[model samples]
Target: DRGPVPVEEGQEVDVTVDSVGRRGDGIARFNNFVIFVPGTNAGDKVKVRITSVRNNFATGEVVKGE
Candidate 1:
C-alpha cells in the first residue's frame, strides 16, 4: 500500500534513466516518484540528487556520470 512520504526538497535519490525529454533531460523514477534529471540521456543508469520538488513532478541532477 502507498504510505505517506516525508521527502524533503533537495534530497538525493537513486533511480534508473528511463527516457529522454525534448529539452534533453533524462527521465527517472524513485520510490514511484518521477524526476527529471539534467545532463543525462535515455537508457543510462544514473543516480539523481533531487533539486526541486513540485506537487506532481520533481527535478534533479545526475549524481553519477552520463
Candidate 2:
C-alpha cells in the first residue's frame, strides 16, 4: 500500500514541518511519502529541495531549512 509517488529528485516541496528529528531535521509527510528535511525546525513552513529518494520515503535539503 506504500510506494514512491513518482516525484523527481531535487524537486522543491512546500511542507509544514511536523516534527523534529534526532539530528534536528524537520519531518514532514506528503501524499503518503515521508520526507526528512534537514536544517529546519519543527512547526515551520518551508520549501525544501529533494535530495534523496527511496521507495517509500525521500529526503530534502532545506532550501529554507534555516
Candidate 3:
C-alpha cells in the first residue's frame, strides 16, 4: 500500500536521471526520496509529472527530454 506521499499526482518536477532501475526505468531523487521514471536512462535530465507515490518510491513519466 502507498504510504506518506512526498509528491501529489500530476505534480511536475525537474530531475536528473541518476541511474537505471532493474526494469529499465530511470531513477531520480528529491530530498533523497526515490522516483522511478519510465523511458529514461542514466545521466538524462528531464522533467516529469508524478503519477504515483509510495512509502519508499514514486513513479512518474517523462514530460520532457530523454
**Best-matching candidate per lDDT:** 3
For 1-66, candidate 2 gives per-residue lDDT tens digits of 564475669799888889998888778887757898887777888888888888877898767643
Q: Which 10-residue window in model 2 sums to the lowest lDDT?
A: 1-10
Clashing pairs in 3: none
**Candidates' lDDT values, in order?**
0.75, 0.79, 0.88
Q: Which residue runs of candidate 3 sit more than 4 Å off their true CA positions?
A: 1-4
Q: Which TM-score value belongs to model 3?
A: 0.86
lDDT, residue 10, model 3: 91
Candidate order by TM-score, highest to lowest?
Answer: 3, 2, 1
List TM-score per model, in order: 0.77, 0.80, 0.86
Residue ranges of candidate 1 with Cα displaced over 4 Å: 1-6
**Each candidate's clash count:** 0, 1, 0
Candidate order (lDDT): 3, 2, 1
lDDT of each residue in 1-66, candidate 1, tens digit only: 345443457677767888988898888877776788888877787767778877666898777764
Clashing pairs in 1: none
For model 2, how big is the CA root-mean-square deviation?
2.1
